[model samples]
Target: MLEDAGGHVRDADDDQMRLECGVFGAWNVAESSAITALGLHALQHRGQEACGIASFDGQLFHTERHMGHVGEAFSGTDLVHRLPGRYAIGHTRYATSGASVIRNVQPMFADLEASGIAIAHNGNLTNFRALHTQLVAEGSIFQSTSDSEVILHLVARSRKGSMEARFIDALSRIEGGYALLALTNECLIGARDPLGIRPLVLGELDDAYVLASETCALEMIGARFVRDIEHGEVVVISGKRTLRSSRPFPAARARPCLFEYVYFSRPDSVVNGRSVYDVRKRMGACLAQETGVDADVVVPVPDSGVPAALGFAQASGIPYELGIIRSHYMGRTFIQPTQGVRELGVRMKHSPNRQVLEGKRVVLIDDSIVRGTTSRKIVRMVREAGAREIHFRSASPPIKWPDFYGIDMPDRDKLLAARKTLAEMQEILEVDSLGFLSVDGLYHAMDAGPRDPVHPQFTDHYFTGEYPTRLLDREIAEGRNDPVERQLSLLVTA
Candidate 1:
């Protein structure tokens, strides 16, 4: 769904937040770079910021990173033909926190070192700037503002010999959500952050083994789905053997980012062995439990919220109504040339059905509210449609914190709930009532069935101030994360 000039999709017939990224990788293969692009095309749903593919063919590495949609960037059949070799990794990105610039493209490579390290990453790192600054102080230079570059510098300085040992050691230094697909001439490595904020799964196709951000991508490339890469698991695909190591650690708490189920991931995919659709539907059901209401109709923001909206309607026995009509033909709004246009475009993208809202108390189910700009806009549209009363229900609890793990998003001030009470948000949006799902509701949506297997590396810092480990100090007096954020805090001085 990538737009031609700018990288965006036209919104068609829905008023839901589009999930933000798409990623894919293939290694130990006969045709690496070409196949990797195919994988990326499969994952085109995860990101649209930029597209890239890096391949290694035993002796040399090849790469192509374009500033626009994947097809437009790599469309020349001659170019695809020229992209030679077998072990490859590809990425499509959406700026998680940073702005969209060629400065933020992915699959960045460093070939000066013997085998080299090429990294394609999904998810934000809470402390990338800090890590980058530390590297720079120690005589390292950077080419892009991307956090993925920090990983390459770490690998470059990694203990000289083994790639696995070097990557594992450096992984300990990074704190945030990551599903990294890294390529070296000798190996293809897939590493997930301690919390597993993003999804990366394993699949097998013919003689080739694949790793991708979702099952849908694997299916698209005719790969057989294996299992998902577990939280904190690092799977290294070498020429002859696939090595995995998950041993070295004190037990870390698992609090996976709840947004994946609420709005981010593709509904057809699975994360942590759970179907995303089922999990989101459950969130909707949970919302219904908390906001049991007597309403004339139930309306869900299109696309992402449909599952939850369905659950809410079924749970409350209120008939579902298609109140919001989306313009599927509309291209992605953000990629619009101007910010004012983007803002105005959101309204043109989705329209409220006046017939459904007229004289009726309507229940609105949204996945989550980030800054409340989109929510407020939707409210205004609904009110203009003559809805008597609008009950707002968010499937997930409020997003009070920013994601450091590569999700392009607002800082603290942008979050409506971060600065105002739910009541305040309701008033600002001009809605009749607002209720959010509980934290327990979020966990249950992903936990599933009788056996709730918790991810070993999940971190819920967005909801809670909690985060992962650090370079330790034996003194029991005080402790904090490896100070990655503390180091980045200095950059604000610039």
Candidate 2:
């Protein structure tokens, strides 16, 4: 089955990491909630668990938050009608900071002493546990267990005179990657972390200013791309249609997540001045150059693998074929709520095309391998379809470290590449051969030159264990001799 743009297929979920959320905000737009909904729809690939929109209709703030796809939650309901406004902010969440539940759904709203504010955040907070512990000890009653709720509490406790100042104060106290959008009675605010670990873009539509996680969101609402919000910068769009900008955090080298180019972002979107599709194609070409194999046909794993497979075919001068067909009607497997059904979902999601694979040497191109479970199933399916030999290629390097920055990655023990050698991985997957892109090749694809050993250009600890920000939670937990701590130590040592 074809993976839903709104959510990952159930079986694929185990093998793919999930981005935390996608955020969108607009100032001075008519029917702002509807427009924000469209923006969230375009950004559905970023998160698929829950969706919410909060809008200020000149007098009062209206909100609609529900657990489901954006279209399911907004299209068939009167939820949009209740959210009439000129300013708005929205979030589509894929639980990373908290458990997947309605209480964790965002565009988390707060009615502070100064004014009401609604925020949609995209990136995980590395110091979440520390901040949460401190805030709770200070008598702050959290509405949800989500790390995002800490920001709301911080804003409420800030002694700053203006709401904007309070917002900036709260942000400065927090650490780690964030691309957030906030809506207040007077203005819409957007900000990015100092290191730019996540993406945030600015756009304009008619008299309105738009802020979204990806350019595709802006394009969906007929907005013109206005350059990315610089790292550490804060932008405020007033109800009067005036736009102001500032830098709240000290200047730092920007290191946007490299995974955005590999798997997280939409192929149609542009992030950090590069086309994601173009970058993925380059990654495929680079992988082909590193390990070109003799094969009768180059087949994409489907959906996410299409562009890369095309590039691999172009580079290797092999015929590209759709050897596997995906079903579009299958819902996410994790939602099955039963182990047996969830396991069965893997077969329902995809089927091998015997005519294309029969007696042919096939090269399979995939974006990445997380657990090797799905890859094993795919290889077996292809083999059963009469494939004589199967070679697997990953566009990204082996992911050895876990991501704490908004990506819901498995623990170190569950990672196939983290625990297994290349030969072991090939043996486990039962493939003829397996190859992965090198870290240097990834940098070349990004056109960022070779990665600097001292200071890497991107947030890529998943491949290289050199983390960009402090992992406060992990550090605190590492002192104990627990299994998790031991695993973390092994990762560090590796």
Candidate 3:
């Protein structure tokens, strides 16, 4: 199920990459209807697998969950008019654990005998199997295989007196990254796991308090950016009050996943006040500072690599050119979540430009190389366009490990980098030369800023065979944290 979902697009601009899911939660004490709709649009880049929104009109809760983009699902007056309320929360999903089906679409909601609860989740848990086993042993039936659903069931089964206590209890049992938003009769709650593996920021629009995975969503709704929901912070906002509980909830606090900046987030986003685009560009500049042989023309794979390409060009003094043009008509695979739909989604999306590739030895810059299927295809396309030689360069180190965060990738058996060397990958991709930035290069690039270095990062198991943060690290061989590691200067001796 993980392998089949969440492909971004072929190369609309010559790059192929995966985007992690997005999360948006709004507590509209200001009573904004279209605000939630606009918030979904801002988060459109996060996940196209499915989109949903649940609103509370004080007395009743209304929800709209469907498989597609927000604009496509909630259309015209009929869909918008049905949801009228002073409080609303929304979600846009990219399938991680659960299969891509309408039945699995979220803002997942349920009505227990006592109260009805709605939730939108933006991360994955590592101990899902154990938790599922325990839950099923107690005979708590599951509606979907998604680890996210486990959270809802946990909350439902342990409904003590107050919803906050029940939610805290649910969070206590889970072991992984999550940025969750739950809406109920009296209030809205936003919770980020102790490690802060995912991002959930706080925003304000008049008297409204909105929670989202990125700052771009806040800008989309004209909401003023307030601050990041700190690592392991559980904040509850209502029409009348606001409350918060810090980390160390009888459990260890670890780290946030680093991919939120590298690939998952929109380039325009400012995660924890750090510019994601700037971070990626710095990574490229650092890479160029350390590497880059005598190359002909520097060309980015597209989209994700554009900023980095510019940085590399500036740093290396190599002229950056639009060497590869992408076919924008190609639709995104994440939009069509299911396997069958994705098979067709790729075809509908990317195409290569023959104009610049007709005769050139190009240095292709990309964020990271995962399975190498798309990379192989890209090289093939460039070759067919009459390129003399294609030198593939990755700004980040080869991703030899699969992510336990929200990204869905092929299993270990299918990950090319995990099983092969650079030469092996070059032979497979049919490239003249292939180079990836060292792990240390990427860290030096990201370390210049004033942000907390320990907040979170992708699981470094691929390069080091160890994890930067202990929260999501396990014996799984490969994996995907928040909080700083003071010992980062010690290089991983891979």
Leading candidate by lDDT: 2
> Each prediction's TM-score against the native?
0.85, 0.93, 0.85
Better of 1 and 2 by TM-score: 2
The residue ranges of model 2 lying beyond 4 angstroms of the native Cα positions read 1-13, 76-80, 96-98, 333-343, 480-494
lDDT of 3 by residue, 46-123 (tens): 887788888877787888888888888876776546777777778887654335676677788888666678888887
In model 2, the worst 10-residue window by lDDT is 1-10
By lDDT, the candidates rank as 2, 1, 3
lDDT of candidate model 2 versus the reference: 0.87
Assess candidate 1 and give its TM-score to the true structure: 0.85
Q: What is the full ranking by TM-score, best candidate first?
A: 2, 3, 1
The window of 10 residues in a row where model 3 has the poorest summed lDDT is: 485-494
lDDT of 2 by residue, 103-183 (tens): 989989999877899989998887677778777888999888787899998889888888899999888778778998889
> Model 2, 159: alpha-carbon shift in Å?
0.7
Give the local distance difference test score of model 3: 0.72
